[model samples]
Structure formats: structure tokens, C-alpha cells
Target: MTSLDMTREALARAERESAMKSRILATVSHDIRTPLSGIAGMSHLLGQTRLTPEQANYLAGIGQSVQALSQLVDDLLDFSAIEAGRFKLHPRDDDLRQLIESVVEILAHRAHEKGIEIASWVAADVPGLLSFDPERLRQVLFNLVGNAVKFTNEGGVLVSASMVEGELEIRVRDTGPGMSVRGQERLFREFEQVGEEKSRIGGTGLGLAISRRIVLEAGGSIAVESELGVGSTFVVRVPVGQPSDFRLRQARATMLSSTHMLIIAPDGVCREALAAAVTSLGGTVRLAATPADLLASLEHAADAFTDIVVDRRLADFLSEELCKHPVFRNPATRRILLIDPETRSTTRFLGAGYDSWLVRPLRERSLVGVLQGRMKGIELRDPINDNRSNSRWTQAEGSGLDVLLAEDDPVNRLLLKTVLKKGGHRVSEVETLRDLIAAATQATGRPGAIVTDLSMPGGNGLDALSAIRDFERTNRLAEVPIIVVTGSAGSETRKAAIDAGATELFVKPADPAKLAELLASYAARRAG
Candidate 1:
């Protein structure tokens, strides 16, 4: 009780707290910086020149390194936020149906790659409108779904939701190596894993911990059930109504049975491609090469069309008019403006009351994702072959080959070039879609497979693929294989690239070794 005794005890406590803070910061920095360094270094290496096919693959492996590192960093940040009780919830009225669809769309590609099918079933009994934070819900679900996909080596991940006694119950089930009793008990503890195998799989092990915190904060509860070597299921239950909660009415309110899509572009090829992609997605697409034709079409079908999608160049000419027009002013109709990456100005479109902004070459998946997000009831069918139950291609050894590299980022281009070159493949580089076409046409002299980025200025990888297909149709080029590379492997983007004629899709920061193996396989196929 003495003043001296109190001061001594207080000093010790402060010192202990400071030391713990220092330790935490050091661990986080190491965890975050490791993968970031790999991403930057490998990306830089890939941009170099004169790379062999094998070397190019080594650079691809760098991307996987970055992803693993990024996940760890995110887990740490989320854990910290939860522990501080500083994590805030911004709840809004959301359509649970749409939210589940969005999560499925995001994770579909990864599941497909693993030969796993993901099916979602939302119970009709569950209320369409619920009060919750969309982003937080997405984050929580993403962690669960992502874990399901990552841990499962066979079967698939299924997400289903229903209402049970006034509570919304969302379940994520996966057929993978299941957890043990001890694993289940420690699942929600920070920096903890069930076993050695899990630690090697590269998780910071904070996903379940963060999920528990978020669910609890939202007045919800989460539980897990699993059996060894069979599968696991995670269930989240949250109450449906609270007086302060905001409710999002069903998307069916704005649903359209038929949709009209207008693609306005100066280039005929680009216009046709956009039209085709839209049509493939169950929309009636109209191509307008000029502003006059576009305007005429809009005016003629003012009431018939449910939505209007226009190129950025054409958007400028029609934005003001569309906003003031009686048809667009109606709440039922929606407008989406498409901009080329080169056009950075968003001021004009925002002023015109456009519902969304899209950038070219507008991957089909992204477009559909945006549409599905904006519209309430339009359902999107699975793009992958669900019946195909084959496992991923086995890892292969390097077979010296030639590679055609197409990318816009100077750093990424150089990095890929370096890696491929080191792997012992002859590498040629191109920056634009036009150049890619030219290179493919001239491939007879230096025949090889193509590796291209999805997004590029002055045309893109998909455009180049279309041109290559045309050349093949005319017998001007051989049936050379192509790989599409991208940053965000959204379900829509992957499906779009594949539908556009890519042989395989690789997400950014991919493993270089895997890229090399793919190239080697292409070479073997060409020889066979």
C-alpha cells in the first residue's frame, strides 16, 4: 500500500507491455515483408529478356510466394483489429441470396482448378432482406470458403444457407482431409494450427479466430464439425432482425426477364467481341460503331431495354443526354459505362448518374459479376464443366521450348522474360494485343506457345487470342497453345478468358515452376 511499492509495480507492468508490443511488431513485419519481397523480385525478374521456357516458369513461382505471404499479413491485421475491440461494423440491408452468389463467383475458379465443384443452395424460407455489413459478411465467408478450398484435395466445397427458428444459418462444407478432435478445439486460437501438415500449407492460422470474433460481434455464433480424412463443415448462425438493422429488399424488385446490351466502340472487332460475350451470357447485344447508331438504338428501344452498357468514348457523347432522358430517369432501368484503361477520367460518368463503371477489354466474368451485383434476380449458371472429375496436371520437368510473352507492365514483362530465359526457353516479348497477333502470325519461323496478361492497353490478351483463332481458321498460323495471366482471378474473368480461347488461366504472382511445366507440356503436345 506504500507509494514506493505502487510505483515499482507500475514501472514493471509498463515495461512488460512495451516488450510485448515490440515482439508483435517484429513478427508482423517479417511475415508481411517476406512475400512482398518475393512478389516484387519475381515480378521484376519475369520482365527480363531472352528467357528459356524453364526459366520463365521459375519466375511464375514467385507469384505463389506473394499470395501465401499476403494471406499471412491479412490474418495478422484482422486478428489485431479483433483483439483491440476496435473492429467496427457498418451494417446495411443486404440480399443474402446475392451475397452468397457473389462469394461463390469469387471462389469458383479456385475450386475448379482443384477439380472440386461448388454448389450453393439458399433456402426459400430465409428472409431476402437482412441487416448486416456486406463487406464483413463477405470477409467471413471468404475465409471459410477459402479454407475449404485450400484444405480439400478432392470432392468439393458447398455453401448453403437457411432460416432455423428466426436465425440465419450459413454452412460451409468441404470434402478434404478433416480435422481431429484437438484441431477442432484449437481452431479459433491465434497462431495455432491442428498439425504440422497445416503449418506447412502456409496459413497464419488466424482465419477461424477472426471469423469467431466477427460473428460474436454481430450477435452471432459459429461452430465446426469434422471427421478425419472425410470432410468438415463450418456453421454460422445469426439472428435475423433488430430494430436498428437496415433491410435490403430482394433484387427481384429490379429483375428483368430480358436484357438489351449496347456495345459502342470505334473498332469493329472489339465491338463484335463485346456483343458476342454479352450474347453468350443470355443478353440481347447490339453493336454500334458510332454515337449516332447508339443513340438511335437507345431511343428506339427506350422502354424495351433493361440496361445500357456503353464504351467510355461513346459514354461522353451520351452521358448527359441519358441522365436527363425520361427513360433513364426511371428507377427500373440501369446504365453501365465502360471505359478503356487509358481513359482515367471518371468525373463525367459520375455526373451522369451511371450505375457502374467498367474498364476494357471487359472480361466477360467481370461484366457478368457487375450485372449480377447490380440486378436482383438474374441467376448466373456455372461456367465450368462440373462433371469433369480429373485432378490437376502433374508437375512436369523442363523441356526446352519457345515462349511468346505478352504483357503491358514493364516490370512484370521484364521479370517474366528473365525467369523464362533462365529456364532455357527462347523468349520473344510483345507489349500490345496488336503485337501479339503479329507475333503469332509469324510463329512459323519461331514456333512456340504464348503467355499473355489479360489486361493491356491498345488491345488485350483476349483480343489477341481472337485474332490468333482467326489466323488459324485461315491457315495463316498453327494451333499454338496460350495461357492467360491476371491479377484478380475473379470467377467471371477466368471463365471469360477460357471462353475467349485460352488454353489455361494463371492468376498473378503464380508459381514460375508451374508456368514452366505448362510450357513444357505444350512443347510435348506440339511434338506429339
Candidate 2:
């Protein structure tokens, strides 16, 4: 055969092999991840319980492992995208500090086990919002910090971010055994783990390599500085920008100067942060370091402070104290609580003593809105209070969703039903395509959402999906959000499900938290 013909044939084979590999990986990932969803979902539910510190720690470990596994699958998918030159960048205004904090918080569990502190600091001059692909940035941080925690056996990982001349410079420094000059040369090469240290620390070794690619794709430079025993630092510099109208937040914050707020928080960092958030509101802020100081301040004229925000440390213990305190009992005194999502249940404090609670790490807008609304005497449309759909995922008992679930396996069906029911959804279980048809065509009111499995005894999920679409068109029925979940994973099956009218498709091991969020969004949209 001619050289060109042979080369063409080889290229064709490589393409075919790549396609098959992608298909196989997708199926395997679905099979593996389907069960992980249950593990993650149940773990989340378990975390909500009043467990001991030991039990909570154990649950946290499980969560970290699951998260790590999820990231592995994501990395594989991303690698494929890069190879195919199909990696799409979606840039929008994102809070860079929040993104950095989220990365650190998620990996904090693993670091804690090794006695390594994950600390992060964003420069004071950094913009409140910057345009970037949050997912890609998250991927980069996840890989870099995750590796930092793995290789480091000593002090910790410190993430320092600053904007210099319109470029975001992020440095991930770790007090671990560092790589040599020769090792640094091959560090960012695909699947290359330089040292024996990396060998002992388990990873696919695609992390740093993938991170480098992501940085380069974002028009950024990623470089490393290291010595044999002095630990290593990964440096990344990317363009930082914001949307055209960046002053709207500042404009709103300008109005807070007329409002007086007494801010109380426990940790010095959090206290300063919360105080800064209040200051951004253009308000007069008096920060109290302790509950005692807050109480002393409250002892003054009730009107002295238009608003009082207690720390998470004080919210739960103050219900009775609030009733007894004359200043607190006054209806004009607006009280807000800075709360932890996992530890402090916001519902318990809301209406108990607090006017509203913002979940930590606190968002400036939420703080400003509560303070401003109170100042204007404009009744706050509490997202939770005004709309059940807003809190449906966390507080699902009142969502009132009529849900249709189709699954052939009794165990899977029961699991789905239990989760949906617990999530305040009225689920109608059907095991076959015939049953799905019956449920869809019946004269009764249609469900708010439908969950279906792809493969079943009576017919496949796509068959049921097609039937639902036809029925919707024939009867001019309202489009209900349909989620297709199946163990059978393939491009054809996925495309078919989408074409036949599935709103979302998830492979098994799909996190229930994600499903809950999706359902909540749909419910909120429909309600609105």
C-alpha cells in the first residue's frame, strides 16, 4: 500500500478506537456512578442527622472519597474534550474568592486527616466579580490543591490570589517534599508522574497535566517553582475582567449608609468579613466581637441600631434570651443571623428570634437586601417564606410535586419513591412501558415531573419517552420536566432520550442533591 494510504488507514483506525473508548468509558462511568449517587445522597441525608463528632467525621471521609471519585470521572471527560479539541469555554461574571474558598473547603477533609491546614487569601484590591469559566477554574484548583494535600506531609497548602495589572495571579504553595529541576521539566506532560513520592500518592497523574492545558486554553500561564526538600508552588496567571455594568452592586451598597447595623461574629476573620459586607452596604457598622458586647450594645436605645446580626455561634442559644430582652423584642429591631448551612438550621432561628438568616460563607447581596428592606419598611419577600419552591431541596416537606416514576426493578423503584416522597413529591410508580403509557394518558392531572429508567421489561425508557412526547403533542398537554436515568449509556441512547423529550439525562450514581436542585428549579420556574 502507498504511504499516504497506509497513514490514512491508521488515522481512521485511531479515530474509531477513540470513539469506542469514549463509548466504553461513558457506560462504565454510568455503571460506577449510578451507585455512587445513592452513596452520596444517603451520605448527605445521614450528615443532616444529629450524629456524634466521630460519626460525622467518618461521614465526611466517605463524602470526600465520593467527591474524589466524581472528580476522577470529570477529569477523564475533560481530557477527552481536550483531545477532541471540543473543550468549550463558558465565561461569565463569577466571584473568584468564593470559587477559591469552595475549592479549599471541599478538600479540607483530606487535608485535616494529614494535619495540613488549607488556607486561602484573596487580595483586597481584587474585583468583586471577574469573568471566567468557573468550572474550569474549579478543575484547576481541585487538581492543584488536591495534589498539594496528597504530597504534603508537613505544614499545609496556602492559596494566595491577587490581581496584578488586570491579570489574576493564583499561587498554590505547599510545604511538601518538592520536585527536582529535571522532574519539573516533565511535570505538565500528559499522565507523567515524576517522582517515587507521586507513585506512593495515588492518582491518575492527569491532574497537573490537565490543569496546564486548562490554563493554556484560558490564555493563562501555569508554571512551577520548587526545590528537592523545600516544597513546591504552582503559579497561574489569567486575565481578569467583569461584566460591562459592574457598578450596580456598588450602587446598591451606597444606599446602606443611612442604616445602622450591629454586627456580631465569633471568628476574627469572619467578623471582619461580615463587617466589610455590611460596610459595602454603605451602612454605619458597629462590630461586636462577642455576644456580651452585642448585648451591651443592644442595651442602648433600641433605635440606636436599626439592625442586629448575631453570629452563628449565638443564633440557636438566643431564642429565649431574645424573648426576654426588651430591645430584641421590639418589632422595629430587625435581626439577621450569619449561619452555617450544615450546622445551624436556619428554619429554627427564622421567626424564632431572627428576622432572616444568610448561609455562610456570607453573600454581600443577601446581607444588604435584608438590611435595606428593613430600613425602607418594605416587607422582605423572603425567598424561603414567599416561595416553597426556593427551599424545596433543603425543606422538601411542602414542595407539593406530583411526580411520576418508571423503573422495572422493584428495589430501584422503591429507592426512587422513598427519596421523592421524602423530598415532598407524590410519586406514581410504574414498572413497564404500558404502565408509563397508562399513567401519561390517563384523564387525571399530569405530574409536575417524570423520572424514567431507559431499559425495562415492557419496553425501553426511550419508548416511554416517545410515548409521553406523542401524548403531550396530541392532547396539547403542558410540558412536564422529564428526567431520564439509565444504566445503559451510549451516545445513541442519550441523543434518543433528548430527541424524544427528556429534560435531563443522568447516568446512575447521579447525586440526589443534584436531582433535588434540578427539581426545585423546575418547580420554582413553574410556580413563578
Candidate 3:
């Protein structure tokens, strides 16, 4: 046989193997996630009901386990797609700082449990918005930071982003036991775990491999620098497309030009980053690491800062004292609290003379908005007098909607129905495409939103969605929000759903809380 013919045969075999692997992964993903969706859904329901402390803890553990398993499935699926050359990057303009903050926020609980701090910093020069695939970028950062947190016990993990020569560079540095020379060589290889404590620190070792593929696909490069006893830092550099408008930059500069701000954060990195951002935007900044420093600076300084941003942790120490502080009470100065997302007693803080609150790890756009007075502060209402019925934040249990749910599986259907009902929504279920189309089109009253699973028994959800869209257009009706919740994670699947007029797409085992939030937002938008 000719050499060319032999090469062709070899290529054919490889292609067949790749296709088979992708198909197997898809099957595995669906099978595992189908059950996981039920488990996660039920746990979420259990959480709402009154439970003993022990039961709550057990439920939390179950939730975490489900998340871990789902993550594993996702990792395997992503790797398979990359290997099969089916991985695609969908880049769009998004808030880079917000994305980084979200990843850090998600992992902060774990870091705090291990007595380690996890923080993020985006360079002042890095535009507030950049063109990139936010979800894919999030996945890469999550894996890198998660791995860093898992391996580190003593110090902490710091994820920082900077713009270098028009390329977006992200560095994840950890004070963990670093890799040796030999270990570094195989670090990005599939299923390769290094270090003596590899068993103790568990992972499938496909994280770096998958991350590398994602970065490379985005026309980027990822590398690591490490020493045996010191630490490891993973650097990812990717070329970004359109940044925020130059006119907006000018506006930011103009708004902040006359501003003098005070930033109080215990974390040194965060404190400096805030100062840098402010300084870059043509503002003057003062840094205080402690309450005492803040007080002293206020007392000694001639001019009062226009804005005082206090970390919620430090505010706890100040407590009632903050309300009495001269600088905090000054009408000329805005009091902004840098709050953790899990902080629930915010009403008290807001009542105690805070003008506004920024959820930490802070996003640059939010900060700019707050500082510029473009983002309005919460209205100071009497806590006792305020029933909060009229407040924008009131959604769950406050208002309900008519929902049409399409799912073939009983367990999955129950999960969706329960979640919607729990949020006070009236749900109508349909198990087949025929029923779905009939209910959506023939019904007298329109549903506020439609939640559907893509792969039904007889016909696909996409077909039903397309039909619904056609019906809407034919009848000159307002388009309903058609949210697709599917097990398929393929880019093609996502594109197809969007093409079929799906309002949004969510992978299976979607968080009930987030789903509810989405519905609330949809309602809110419509009402507005």
C-alpha cells in the first residue's frame, strides 16, 4: 500500500475514535446530570423548609457533592469537545472585572474555611468591558483558582488581571507547595497529577489541560512558574477585541477628576488596587487598612474625602460607632460599604447611615458608577415603617407568574414544577412537543415565560420553540421568554436553541435560586 493511503486510513481511524469518545461523553453527561438535577433540585427545596442545624449542614454537604460531580461531568465534556476539535469560543463584550470578582466570590467561602484569603485585582488600564467568552473565561479562572485554593493551606490565592500590550493577561498566584521540574513538564497533560499529597488533594488532573485548550482556542497562551517550596503562578494571556468606548473613558475621567476618595480594605492587594483604579480615573485616593487609621486620617487630614468606602468586615468593628463618626455622617461625603454577597444584615448597615453598598469583590464599573453618583444609593426608609412590598428587590413570594414548563422526564418535571411553584408561579406542564405547542399557542392566556428541556421523547424542544415563535409572530403577540434547560453542553446546541428563538439557555441541573432570579428579572423588566 502507498504511504499516502496508509496515512489516510490512520486519520480515518482517529476521526472515528474521536467521534465515539464525544458520543460516549454526551451519553454519560445526560445520564449522570439527569439524576443530579433531581438531587440538587430536591436539596434546594429542602433548604427552604425549616430544618434542624444538623439537617441543614447535611443538606449543604449534599449540595456541595452534587456541585462537585456536576463539575466533573462538565470538565470531561469540555475536554472531549476540545479533543474532538468541536470546542468553540463565543466572545462578546462583558465586564471583565465583574467576571473575575464572581469567580473569587464563589471560591471565597472555601478559602476562608482553610484560613486563607482569596482576592482579585483588575488593572486600572484594563477596560471595564472587554470582548471575550465570559462563561469560558469564568470556567478557566474557576479551575485555576479552585486548584490553587485546594493546594494552599497556609497563605492565600490572588487572581489578578492586567492589560499588557493590548493583550489581556490573568495571573493566578498561590502560596502552596509548588511543582518540581519534572512535575511541571507533565502538568498540562491529561490525568497527570503531581506532588506527594496528590491523593490528599484530589482532582481528575484535566483542569490545566482543558484550560490550556480553551486559552489556545482564543488565540491565547497559558504557562506556569513555580518553585518546589515557594509557590505557583499560572499566567494566561489572550488578545481581546473591542474595549469600552473612548467617550466613556473620557466621561469617567471627567466625573472622577474632582473626586478625592478614601478606601478602607484589610487586604493590602485590594486596597492598592482600589487606589490605583481611582488614581487612574483622575481621582485622588487615601488608603486605610484599619478603623483606627481611618479615624486618624479623618482627624488629621485638612480636607475630607468626597467618598469613604469601608469594607464590611471593618465596619463590623465600627458597628454603631460608624453612624456617629463625623466623616461617615458628613452630607458632603458618600458612605459606601464594600459588602460580601452573603452579608444579610445589610438593612441594619443601610439604616446605620450607609449611602450605598457595593458587593465585593468589587467590580470596576459598579465602583465607577457609585463614585460618579450615576448609581443611586438606597433610600433611607424607617425599617419598622417599611413593609418592602414596593421595593424592587422584593420578588420571590412577592409576585408570581403564569409559567409553561416542558419536560419529558417525571423527576425533572417535578423539580421544575416545584421550583416554579415555590416562587409562587402558576405552572402548566407538558410532556410532549404536541402538548407544548398546543398549550402555548391555543391557550387563552399567555404564559409569562416558558421553561423547557431540549431533548424530548417524540420531538425536540427546539421544534416546539420554533413553532411557538411562528405562532407568536403569526398572531402578532408579544414574544414570551423561552428558557431552554438542556443536558447538552455543545456550542452547536446553544446556537441551535438561540436560532430557534429560545430567550435563554441553561445547562441541566441549573440552580433553582438563579432560575428564580432570572424569572423575577424577566418579570421586572416587563413591568418596567
Candidate 4:
């Protein structure tokens, strides 16, 4: 063969090897997660039962262990996929503020346990809906924040994201013991751990390595800055891909133009974030470091401020005193509290003369809406507990629909069935592709929804989905929502499933809570 022919053959061989590795990894991942899902599902069910404190601790331990194991498995598979050139990015349009808040929420428990605060903020200029892979981006944030929380003992961690130039810049700053120059140099190396107390902090040490690779693959850069006695900050900048439907909505949302506000935030970081948000929306703002400062500013200023935004910590200190003040007593001036996420209730604020509240690491949209009196305080409710009384869920549960579930594994099938039953749905179980197609096409009445696994004994689930879709079209029947819960992690598998008419695809082991929520939504949609 010629040199060019030889090179082509080599390239083809490498592609084939990568494809083979991808298939093997998918099978392995699915097999491992299938059983993990069973454990997780049973754990969820077990927690719902009444138990002693000791039993609850044990159950919690099991959950933590399972989560750790799952993370390990995922990390190993993700590294292998990256090495084999099989890693893929799934980008979608989602709110940047929501993404940052989610990361903080996930790590809030850990930070609280350590007696430290964790918060995030997104600049007003950042578009609400940015095209990015949330899952992958979140993974990087998790590693950065998780490490920061693990090391920091006294101070807190603050994460902020902004649109700088044409890139999205994410900054994760932690008040932990600073790292040495050598430690920073070796930070991104695979399986290398370096820090002041490396011995005390236990991890696979693959997080930063994987994160670096992910960022580089996405045409982004990750860097760090630290000093011996000071803390550290990890900054990641990625190219921002605007969605096809992108618009400068935030720039156009100047409804707060006529609003004048007095802001009081003791925390400098939070105060600046709030001020930026307000001004970005065309509102005028004056900052105060304390209640006295706020009072002094109000007393001297000739302008009648339309709004008063104060942090809950400061408000708690002098709520009564501030409420009695002449300027504070002005009924027209809206009082907005910057509440910490852990504040379980808002009733105390009402009694303290506050009219509205906004959660910290404030989003620009929420800030604008609250200033314009177009939005209400966001109430943090427990989803599982609230579902019992939620009108939508109640309506769906009161008159459940027939749900068809397809899974070759008995354990997964049983787990899914239990979850569906708990949601008040009647389920018909099928194990093979042939049976899935038959049950789906031949049912006397249309199923409320169908949940299936991609890999089946008799045939491929995608093929079954295709056949079912054809039958539905041919018979002029309404299309049923088919949710795919599989172990496959290949992008090709996800693409094929979507192309074959899958409504939603979840990789195993799917959270029982999320799966149930998805089912409930479909039922509710149909009922509506």
C-alpha cells in the first residue's frame, strides 16, 4: 500500500478500536449502575419508613457509600472515554444563574457542616439562557468547590460567573490555606494531590485532572492564583456559544429605570453583586455598610428612595428599630431582604416590616422582578413531602394512568414499578424488545407513558421504539411519551434513541425521585 493508504488504514483501525472501547465501557457502566439503581431506589424507600436515629444513621452511611462508589465508577469511565476519544459534550440552553445556584445548593450541606458559608453570583450582563453542557460544567464546578470546601476550615467559598469579552469566566475563590508554587504546578496531573493537609483530605485526585481535560476539549482555559499565607482562586474561561434564539433580553429589560433603591449588605462581595444587578437593570442604588449607615443616608438624601434592600443578618439585628424610623416607616418604600438559603421560613421577615425577600447570590432577573413588584418571594419547599398536597401531583395521582415499563433486569423492573406505584400509576412490565413493541402497539387504551431500557434481550430498544412510532403514525394514534432509562453512556446511543422517537433519555442509575417527577409531569400534562 502507498503511504497515504497506510495512514488511512491506521486511522480506520484506531476509530474501530475507539468504537469498540466505547461499547465495552457502555456495557460495563450499565451493568454497574443497574444494580446501583436498585440499591438507591430501595434506600429511598427505606428512608420513607419510620426508623430509629441509629438506623437512620446507618441508612445515611449506606447512601454516602453508594454515592462515593458511583462517583468513582463515573470518574474511571469518564477518564477512559476521554483517553479513547469517545467523550462527548451535550450542550443545551439553560439559565447561567440557575446553574451557579445549583452548584452552591449541592455543596451547601457540606459547607454548613464545616461552619462556613458558600455562595455564588452571576453578573447581569451574562445571558439568562446560554448554550453549554450543564452536566460537564457542573462536574468541573463540583470538583473546584468540593476541593475548596474540603480544605477551608475557617472562611468561606465564593463562586461567581460573568461574561468577559466573548468568554464566560467562572471564578471559584476559597479562603483555604494557600498552596505552594510546586503544588500548583502539579495540580492538574492525574492522581496527584498537593496541598497543606493532603494527608487529611482523601480523594481519588482525578477531579482536577479530568476537569482540565474537559475544559481544554471545550476550547477553554483553566488557571489558578494563590499565595502562601493568602487563599486561592481557580478561574475557568470558556467560549460562550450563543443559542440560535439568543437575544439581549436583559439589556432590553429596563423596567426598573424609575426605581431608586438603598442597599445594605455587610458582606462586600454580596453588596457589590447586588449593586451591579440593580444598576444593570437601569435602577439607581446607594450602598450602606450597616443599619446606621442606611439611616444616615436616608436622613440626608433628598431623593425619596422607592426601595430598601437589606441583608437578613443586618435586618435581624435592628428590624424593629429600623421599622420605627420615619423613612423606614414610609409604606411606599418596598423592603426586600437578602435571605440566606438555610433560612427555613419567611414569616419572621413579615413581622420585621419586610414586604419581599430574595435569596442570596442574587440573580439579575429576580432582582428586577422584585424591584418592579412583579415577582413573589421564592419559597423553598421539599419536593417529596410537598408532592402529597401539591394540586398538580394530587390530580395526577388521584386518577393514575396505565404505565408500560420495559426492562430486562428484574431488579430494575421491580424498582421502577415500586416508584410508579408510589406515584399512583398502574404499570405493565415487559422484558424483551418484542414484548415491548407488542404491549405498546396492541394496548387497548394508550398508556400514560412508557419507560424502557435501551438494551434488551430480543432486540434493540431503539428498533422497538421505531416500530412503535410507525404503528402510532399508521393508526393515527396520539404519540405516547417514552422515557428511556438505560446504562449506555455513549453519545451515539443517546442520538439514536432520540432519532427513534424517545421522549426523554436518562442514564442509569436514574434517580427514582427524578424519574417519578418526570412521570408525574407527563400525567399532569395529559390531564391538563
- TM-score for each candidate, following the candidate numbering: 0.43, 0.67, 0.81, 0.84
lDDT of 3 by residue, 1-528 (tens): 999999999999999999999999999998888788889877867766677778866876887788788888988999888888888888999988888877887777777667666667765567667899998999999889988988888777888888788899999999899999899999999988877765435478888899999999999999999998899999999999865577765665555787788887775445655676677778888777776787777877778789888887788777666767777778999988876545667888778778888765556667788887889543222211111223232345536778999998899899888777767677889888888888889646888899988877667678888999999899889899999988887788889999999988888788776887888888778778
Q: lDDT at 284 for candidate 4?
A: 83
TM-score of 3: 0.81
Model 1 root mean square deviation, Cα atoms: 21.5
Whole-model lDDT values for every prediction: 0.66, 0.72, 0.80, 0.79
Clashes per model (N, Cα, C within 3 A):
36, 8, 0, 0
Q: Report the error of model 3 at residue 391, Å.
A: 13
Instruction: Give candidate 2 misplaced runs (Cα > 4 Å).
Output: 45-58, 109-116, 121-130, 153-155, 194-200, 228-230, 245-399, 408-412, 432-438, 443-445, 454-467, 486-500, 504-508, 517-528
Give the CA lDDT, 0 to 100, for residue 270 in model 2.
52
Give the local distance difference test score of model 2. 0.72
Question: How do the residues 231-350 of candidate 4 rate in per-residue lDDT, one tens digit apiece?
Answer: 899999999776543346555446567888888777544676677666766778888876678778878777888998878777767666675678788988888888766676688776
Task: List where candidate 4 sits over 4 angstroms from the true fold.
Answer: 1-24, 47-64, 90-94, 196-202, 243-260, 268-272, 282-302, 381-398, 443-446, 470-477
**Decreasing TM-score order of the candidates:** 4, 3, 2, 1
Higher-ranked by TM-score: 1 or 3 = 3
lDDT of candidate 1 over 1-528, digit per residue (tens): 999999999988977775676457545544444335346545544434456656545654554566566666556655655554446777888877678767776566566566565556554445556888887788899889988878877777777777687788999988878889988999888767664574346677787788888898889999999999888999999876633322321332223226676665555323544554455435676666665776687677644666667666666676666756576676776667766433446666656677776654334345566676643222223332222211232222244567889877776676676656656667888888888888788645644778887667677666777878877878855577888766533445567888788889876555555776677667677769
Model 4 C-alpha lDDT versus the unseen true structure: 0.79
What does candidate 4 score in Cα RMSD to the true structure? Answer: 4.0
Cα error, candidate 4, residue 298 (Å): 4.6
Question: Which candidate has the highest TM-score of all?
Answer: 4
